[model samples]
Each structure stands twice: as structure tokens, then as C-alpha cells.
Target: MSQFAGLAVELEESGVKHEMITYSGAPHAFTVFGSDRYREDADKKSWMAFTGFLEEKTGVKAM
Candidate 1:
């Protein structure tokens, strides 16, 4: 996690656009279906974040 934070900081320092969204206590594969660790809220949140990121970079809203 520190590495990710460091990367985010580095990106900011280098003037690159970036965003980070962390789901606290979300286990691995939290977005995968049929997994015991799957979380509906986290899955939805992750997809929304991903779509938003894509839209923010590409200027096209996802359907």
C-alpha cells in the first residue's frame, strides 16, 4: 500500500493526473463473481470508479 501511495505521490509530483480509491477491509477478488470475498458494494464502487476514470481521461461517458 505504501508503494501505491508513493507512486501516487510521484505521479502528482511529476504533474501527472491520477486518482486512488481504496475500499477498506475489502479482500482480494472483491470484485469477482462467485468468490466468497466478493462484495457487491465494493464491486459496484470499483466499476464506477473505473468507468469514471476512463471517462475522465477519454471524455466519453460510459453507458
Candidate 2:
């Protein structure tokens, strides 16, 4: 199994609520919008995922 799959298995065994995402070709710092390493697709997707998680868990909508 792939690394992410293995991690999913581990999380399942540990009974933890979790989510996993991978950016296929995104470089490091992909979330830093103005940085040279930024990747627009990954950044936007990740930000949306992050905000969704935050709102779900804390009930605070992202601005």
C-alpha cells in the first residue's frame, strides 16, 4: 500500500478521526500564496480543506 494508505490504516487502528490529502507535484510551501514555491491548485484546495475542517470542528466560519 502507498504511504498515505498505510497512514489511513494506522489511523483506523488507532480509532482517530482523520483526513488525508496529497498534492501530487506540489513543492514545499505550496500554501504560501506569494512564495515562489506556491502552487495555486494545491494552495486553494488545501485552504478549502483546512477551512472546512475548522468550521466543522469549531463552528467558526473562515473569512
State every prediction's TM-score relative to the real structure: 0.69, 0.70
Model 1: residue 21 alpha-carbon error in angstroms: 1.7
Model 2 / residue 8 / CA error / Å? 1.4
Q: Under the 3 Å rule for N, CA and C atoms, how many clashes does model 2 have?
A: 0
The candidate that achieves the highest TM-score relative to the unseen native structure: 2
Q: Candidate 1 residues 1-63, lDDT tens each?
A: 898799999999999976677898788789889988999998998999889989998999999
Q: How far out, in Å, is residue 27 in model 1?
A: 0.8
Worst 10 residues of 1 by lDDT: 17-26
Clash totals, every prediction:
0, 0
Q: List the residue pairs that clash in candidate 1.
A: none
lDDT of 2 by residue, 1-63 (tens): 387799999999999998778887897788786888989989888889999999998999999
